[model samples]
Target: MFCNQCEQTAKGTGCTKVGVCGKQPDVAALQDLLIYALQGLSLVTAQARAKGVSDAAVNRFINEGVFSTLTNVDFDPARFQVLINEAVAHREAIKLRAGLTVDNPAATFTPAATLEGLVAQGEQHGISEALEAHEDLRSLKQILIYGLKGVAAYADHAAILGHEDESVYEFVQRALVKSLENLGVDELVGLCMECGQINLKAMELLDGGNTGTYGHPVPTEVPLGPKKGKAILVSGHDLKDLGLLLEQTAGKGISIYTHGEMLPCHGYPELKKHPHFHGHYGTAWQNQQKEFSEFPGAILMTTNCIQKPVESYKGNIFTTGLVGWPGVTHVGKDFSTVIEKALEMPGFAADEDKGSVLTGFARNAVLGVADKVIAAVKSGDIRHFFLVAGCDGAKPGRNYYTEFVEKVPQDCIVLTLACGKFRFFDKKLGDIGGIPRLLDIGQCNDAYSAIQIASALAGAFGCGVNDLPLSMVLSWYEQKAVAILLTLLSLGIKGIRLGPTLPAFITPTVLNVLVENFDIKPLTTPDEDLKAILG
Candidate 1:
């Protein structure tokens, strides 16, 4: 299985054996086939739309299927088999209804019952297909595909909150078909930028859904230590799951604590108001194996970034909403089993004093104090804005982000989002002109907030976003960051510093294209990069 859809792809190149994320060959093959089938579904749907017919069910399923293929989300080949068959059925249904002829191999191919047959089909439709094309064109195709994966993930989150944008779904289908065409490098590059543009709308929809449902996030202190009680540790980025668990566990002597991306949930008033909704429990998702095992409670994984469970804590693991492990219990919105397991486990013997970290500086929270921030910038109280954001990884060079944050000048302000903040979130960065020097934005999905805040700052300065005194220092580990990066490029925002490494899928020629077109580059030493930016 050759896969390089994530930051940790083996040796900064395609993973030809087991995935760096622990995905086995069979699972990788299945995911590729699933995407291939989904593309077939997209072709039929795109054709159907031309005949004034669109299937919302097919659109929702496409979003969900793409989200499941994201890193660390699902590894069960059995599950992918079911999704692939469903996509085939959906494709056929759409074609019959629209009276359109199915011309693509994906639309007419039948999956063999045996694993050998399935693997053969997947090999024909995998990234190797891109390899058969021109190098630059292949890179552009991969970029567009990865960006859509991010869009699907965010759009799924919004759909959970009863927020749906048909236009985003339509763009996804159109782009999928576009990527398969015999387009030139320039056309494919244009399509890649379009994916980024649509992602901005997708992020905005998710932001609206989250804030609309949970209320705007306010600056709140989330304890890093445990509280004394039975607890349910909720991880991943699904606020709906966390809210449901909070409601089910209320007054049951169980404390619901956030983990991973859920760390920013404390700043939302609606979630924070729960008397038993206690503090955070662990660090980023990468550290879950050690952290989850030590904690004496049930663990609910709501979405992606879930590692395969170790024996010690596997019994306590429960997954919901598209996250799955081979043997872990999968639940619906109802988390009764998770609550029961939490109650059955030994409660925290005593509370610790690990202090707290402040989060919830989403767009509204930051913009609410726009006047104060603007005054600080004008008076030179705040000299620079560094968006130290994106996914965190266990790789070596990741320490650059932590070190960079440490050495940032006292007068500068830091805006961070996603799990990357955990690297230096515990550090004591004080306030600047009444605003915290290090402002914690919401989750990775809250990249929308960062974009909004940057645009607002540019407006105040009477310049484009790139002309502001702000620079985006991002560390991407997965596809959501891909979509956000595309969104930035689509908006013509340049000078983004991305690390710990560039994607393995991007050939050097394609890398030069990104460097030339968007002015994107890899991170240098923290000191060197800082001097270059500040000088």
Candidate 2:
């Protein structure tokens, strides 16, 4: 299988048999085939563009197809097989129209209908095709590829909200074509930075789409406990699917609770105003196996981070928006079946009182109180601002994030996003001048919010973003975090403390480039790192 696109890769190297995330060898092979097919599709699309023809449909399909290959996102080989066939069909149609004769294997390759044949085909196109024994070129190529996966995920989300950026689509095609070229280490490294720049624009489009559609998120307290009666738990990062379920179940008895990345939905005023929208149900994605089983009602996973389900809860798991399990139900815009299942089961029995945590400090929420925050900083009431964010994982060293947040000075503010905040999200960090010391931003996509807030602060303080008293202590588990890190590096942001461990795919030579140019370092003890940042 040879998948190492995530933090949980086996032995910090590669997953060659079964994926640590429970992806089978066949499924991994299908994912590789699907990626290979997309590169072919990219070739066709790039040629089509040269002829003054661009297919938004092909662009959107490319985004969704690449996103499905992300670790822990989709494990359904059948789905990938279908996507592969579709990619071939799309490329053939586009090539016929463009009247171009490209000799790329990805463009003309034929797949066998049998699983073994598909696997054989994929073996030829796996990431090892980069074959740069030179190490640096290989590493940069891998980084660029992974960064595109993150871009696809974010761009897919924006597409759901009816937002499309043509320039970003062109960049995706051009970069994918770069993979076919034997580019030098320097050129591939430049391509990686360009991916970061494009990812920033992609994220900005997503932020606009989300806020424009859902309204700017507002600070609100989300219950840590469940509500009584029939319920449906919504997970993943798709707010559109969650909103549809909420609407369909509103007048009915079904109550909806956000899980994992969906936890931030409560801060959106449009969603929070729903009477049946109960609070967040769990900590983060990693804990879902146990939490999903314990929930009494039906579950709907809208996007990625779905683990292999246990038998006890397998039947209750329904997927939508490209997420699938072998036997789980995959639904469409209509969520009637999910609601019926929720009604058939026991939900909560009775409401529990587990207190609450504040969330929704997205860009608008934070910038709304910009004056107060600026005054606090000027008066030294808030001495430092730490952007502690990124994806969370089950690794042992992750405790450093919790411990670091635990020891932050009372006067500092911790602005966090993504599931990583779950480490200290429930902790009471108090507030400075009515601004909560611990600000919960939205999902990982909302890293744009953190960046915007920092830039605004820098402008107000008459200094560069690096000159501000802020440090980004990040923990990454998947490709989206990689893309975000690239964006930060592209901005020339420095001294980022990243952990629990570095990506297995990053070669030492590439690591040296990152360290020398970005001042990136691994996380240290809470006390020691805090002293270094605050000193």
Candidate 3:
């Protein structure tokens, strides 16, 4: 069970025995098998689409099955088995519907009846075996596969809010089928770029879904402190789940606090309107073990970025949607059980006066003040902008981001999104004139908003985004960050500084291509990088 699909893979190589994300070997094998099943399903689905026969359920399942194999999304072997079985069923149905017969191993694959048999079969299809191609080709395939995982995640989120795009689904199936081919470097790279382009559309759909349903995020100050009441912490990036939970727990006296990526939800007008909606708790997902143990309430994880729950808070933690652990209680759309759990537990006994952080500086809120921002930049009051954003992990070099933000000059504005901002989110960076020096542009899911902000700013300045005075210093932890990076690169955004570590799956030859084509570089010390960017 070797896996190197994430930043924190064991020893920066591969997770051989157990996953760093607490995924057991059996669960790992099951996830591998699930992906194998999806490859087969994708084969059949691609054929069906060509024959003018497509199933919405199968298309949706393709995204779900792929998303489940992402880091920390689902860790239950039982769940993976269910998904595998469902994938086979979908494949068989699609084959029958399309009246086609394909002889590819993936197309004719069959799952074992028992869980042990499934795991054993999965072991044969692990990443090491599946990607046994040339070094460079394997790297490109890894990038493509990981990028697909990220696209599936965003697409799934958008579909949940009633936003659907057939092209996104079509591109997913086409790419999956292409992965099984003996494509060359140029062709595979073209597919990777296509993945980025499709991801842009998926993200646009997600942005519309979120802003259309909850209204554009407005500049709002959210308290980081506690409220005295029955409490429930909502984490991850699902706004709909949080909204539903807010509605159910509103009159029941439960104070809902946003955690991790959910912290940005406070800026959404529809969500913040709930009077009982409390402030944020905890930092990033990495610190959840310590933070969740300290929180005196029930916890709900809506999506990815879930860690192995500690014993202290394991019983109180409930998972919904795709997030799952072996023994933790899983709830559906109705969160009555989560509400009851919060009622049963002792919430915050007293209120605390911890200061608040400003959020909801998404595209709409930021663009709303475009006139002022443009004036400030024209007046030379603002020097440069730094889009310091990405995922945050517990790796050692993550302190680079913390120190980098602290050392950012007073004349520049720091635009941040995702959990990476947790490194220096609480800092009082003040503002350049009326604009805050630190602008929180919502969650990782809100990368589309950040891209829009940059594009709008570039348009106002009559220059390309690269010609603008902005540098992207990104830290990646999982596949979603990989997807976002591809999106940036596909847009011809260059000279980006990515660290704390490079992906192990990328060989030196492949890394040289990125360096030559895109000028992508590994992050150095904060002081050196700061001097280079500002100078």
| lDDT of candidates 1 onward, in order | 0.89, 0.89, 0.92
lDDT per residue as tens, model 2, 374-426: 99989989999888899988878899999999999899999999999999889
Best by the lDDT measure = 3
Off by over 4 Å in 3: none
TM-score of each: 0.98, 0.99, 0.99
At residue 389, what lDDT does model 1 achieve? 95
lDDT of 3 by residue, 1-535 (tens): 8899998999999999999988899998998888888888999988888889999989999999999999989999899999999999989988888998978998888899999999999998887788746989999999999999999999999999999999999999889888888889999999998898899999999999999999999988999899998999999899999999988887898899999999989999999999999899999999999999999999999989899999999999999999999899999999999999999999999999899999999999899998999899899899899989999998799999999999999999999999999999999999887899999998887889989998999999999999998899999999988888889989999999999999998899989999999999899999999999987
Ranking by TM-score: 3, 2, 1
User: What lDDT, from 0 to 1, does candidate 2 have?
Assistant: 0.89
What value of lDDT does candidate 1 attain over all alpha carbons?
0.89
The runs of at least 3 residues in candidate 1 whose Cα sits more than 4 Å from the true structure, single-residue gaps closed, are none
Where does candidate 3 clash, by residue pair? none
